[model samples]
Target: MSRSLFDVAQSIASVERSEIRRTTGRIARSRQTCCKIMNGSGSPPLHRQGMDYGESKDVQKVHAAIQREKQEPRVGLEPLSLWLIGIYALAVFFGGAYLGRFSGSFSGDSLDPGTVPTKSHGPGPGGGGQQQTAELSPAERGKKVFMSNCAVCHQASGLGSQSQGYPPLAGSEITNGGSRRAAMVVMKGLQGPVTVKGQKYGSAVMQLWESLGDLKVADVLTYERQEWGNHGGPVTKEQIAAFRKELASHPGSFTEADLEPVPADANLPGGEEGAAPPKPGEQAKPGAPPQGSVPPATPGAQPPKP
Candidate 1:
């Protein structure tokens, strides 16, 4: 009975040893699978694994980027085309030819041969034997003179202040009057009542401009006659000179009564020419009325039909 019990105990100890070995093998396999899933490899601890491009999405993209960076970029100069080379060569040849033909010792005078080479005369009045030319016309010069001298009282527009006794030159009968009367007024001056353009003006004293030269006085008169719708024609320096001689004895200022009467057949230029008379049988064509002239109004005239 004692021998049988000892044999049973030995058999039980062998079975336990086999069971422990099987459990240890299963634990080792489980640890290997866990390491592979967590670390992306199943290599031994502390031993580096070869890079597996297909192992992970992130590793594959990184490897591709590195490979692209390592490749050298293509760079080189290409020779110019045959047509372009020929064009450049032609431009160079033409440019050289142009420079050689027109250089003119680099003095830059080859193109302008007509230019004066020497300074023979300075640019001034009567220089180079040329007559001194007046830049302003007589009327234009007279306009400047009137603005500076007469415009203060008469005004630039020549419409004087009637209330202040400054007479209007524009549309004035005195302006269109004969040059003799006009010249006398300017040289010797005038005073008291003066009717200009039908407006009665008085108590104003016009100072004499006797010191003004013949040309200046003549220009002023001419400007006054021609401007402001007063077409009395031009006044000449010769006319002013003759008038000055005639008025040599007259020293004092004149009144409105002293001036000569403007006749119907005045000697002024631009006067109406004699029109042809009506024939024996036919009615004559009516002449155009004179400028600034008004016909007498009938007592009870009806309005003309439009």
Candidate 2:
């Protein structure tokens, strides 16, 4: 607050003196103009009166220039607009490519319920069957599928190899059941499984056909159920489809162990249920027959009972 205070006061005085000098210069200019008139210079044409150029005229000209500039669009923005359009075009192209790649492999659409037969099926086991319809002809379709897929494993004529362990499809109880145990069995392949024919199959495990589309899977299965020397009912592709749909989330394929115990009413013998013919030593009742009423009795006939 000692020397600093004096220096600050001196600096303020110097700035005020400079500003006073500039103000006096402008006043000197005004006085010079008055002196010019007094000395007969007459102030050097203060404004050009009637000369087509004044402040108002200059302002009007500037307005017209601004309107002209507005009428013509600015040129620089065009390249910017082009850049924006290019970005939009690239976005659309990539979007289309993404959608195409995502949906291209959808497999739900290739289903064929009634597939054309490739080779001959000759004849099937059962001729007239219960009231039902087949997606594909059982004998023909089953034969083709069996030959193509199952025959390699189960063998031709639906008989599997004994040493190979693949069980026979022909005469399989799984194929010729009264109920739909056959279809259920096919849906879930067997392992260490006993078949409808009452035979134990221990060689190879059955495989699941889950990857086939609903219709094709159904058709192939329908073919198996009704093929060969196997007299069974026709299977529908829809039933197979529905079964697979129900099992879509199942962790693993079905196995014979998962099957419900074979029903008592399932796969009953085809004809009337009759006990086996009596063995020797079993006697016929009195008046049962005129000895040979059994018709063409065997040559080893026993002596007549008293």
Most accurate candidate by lDDT: 1
TM-score of 2: 0.40
Model 1, span 194-235: residue lDDT tens: 888788886889988888877778778777877888766566
RMSD list, candidates in order: 24.7, 17.7
TM-score of predicted structure 1: 0.44
- Stretch of 10 with least lDDT, candidate 2: 268-277
What count of clashes does model 1 give? 0
- Model 2 segments beyond 4 Å from truth? 1-138, 193-196, 260-306
Q: All candidates' lDDT scores?
A: 0.70, 0.59
Candidate 1's C-alpha runs over 4 A off are 1-134, 260-306
- 196-278, model 2: which lDDT tens digit per residue? 45666664777865665554554565566656765555455556655565565767645666665657235322232122223
